[model samples]
Target: MRVRLVEGASLPSYADGIRQVYADVFSEPPWNEDPSAGDRYVERLAADAARPGFTAALALGEGAVGGFATQGTVGFATAWTTPDVFPSGRSYGHVAEALGPDRVEGWLCGALEVDELAVSPDARGAGLGAALLSAVTEAAPDGRCWLLTSVHAEATLRFYRRAGWHQVPVSVPGRAGLVVLLGPGHPAARP
Candidate 1:
């Protein structure tokens, strides 16, 4: 399926479908985010969209998005450039604590940071997730991009690996709860 790249200016037009996909995908398994999580995401998305380099990837299937990517699978992805100074909100702090200041600065700061990528449960195994992921990070500066995912999600970890993301080998210390993955073309990801 084709994944359309929606710039921040046009993201509001796709909010409803994106929220539905977010709720559908995250409400299950390792994420277990509640219905309210979608609400929170919508609110946060506005601020996130305002950030520099904000981009959203939508896989609109006729049945899923009502028109766009509407051939099959309903999946969406979002990403933005990591600020020169890392963020403190959401799980950013946990990531900072886990990787510490040095690695966080060297590997993540200024890189493209994928905030979310969700595919409806019914759409699993259809490759929509990967398509959505590629849509967002395909144009990263120098291919410097990264994201964090739950260590608990084995399949997700596998998916990233298959997509050529290299998992950074760092133990999640204390409450620092995430596994960091560098994109295929990230400079550091190269041998």
Candidate 2:
């Protein structure tokens, strides 16, 4: 599959397909998110696209976007800088504590944050997810990138590990099942 890195501002053209994939992938077990969640995601996506450093990769197949990965520099005057908007409220706090108060915003704001990665259920196992993941994070400032996922999604956890992502051990309050994964060059990576 050819993965195209769509600048966030240009993502509106692919919005419908991305929303369909988001609804399809997240509606299943482990996520079991409501279909309406796709609507909310689309709403947030529109806002995220306008922020600085916003980048999204779209997996193209049969003239449609089969999967997508959205990312941007954290704390870049986007809604993402606000912790309460996330599905897991404590994720921001966890990363903050793990990186320490003085360095938390500095580090995160300078690093690339993968906000969402999803492949349509019908499009899984085709490497679209991996391709999108790689393409989306390839331009991180300071070579750092990070994301959070549900620990209960064993397949997703395994996939990230297989792709060389390291899971951060920090515990997130009110989100015991969440796991933070850092890209290879992230400061928290093990030696």
Off by over 4 Å in 2: 63-90, 97-99, 102-107
State every prediction's TM-score relative to the real structure: 0.89, 0.80
RMSD of each: 3.1, 6.3
lDDT, candidate 2, equals: 0.67
lDDT of each: 0.83, 0.67
Deviation in Å, model 1, residue 6 alpha carbon: 0.8
On residues 1-191, what C-alpha lDDT tens digit does candidate 2 reach at each position? 56777766776666677777778778998989998897888888897787556777787665323354433211111112222222224367666655566545544556777888887665567677788888878777666777878888999899999889998776644554777788877766848
The alpha-carbon deviation from the true structure for residue 42 of candidate 1, after best TM-score superposition, in angstroms, is 1.4
Off by over 4 Å in 1: 63-73, 174-176
Which is the leading candidate under lDDT? 1
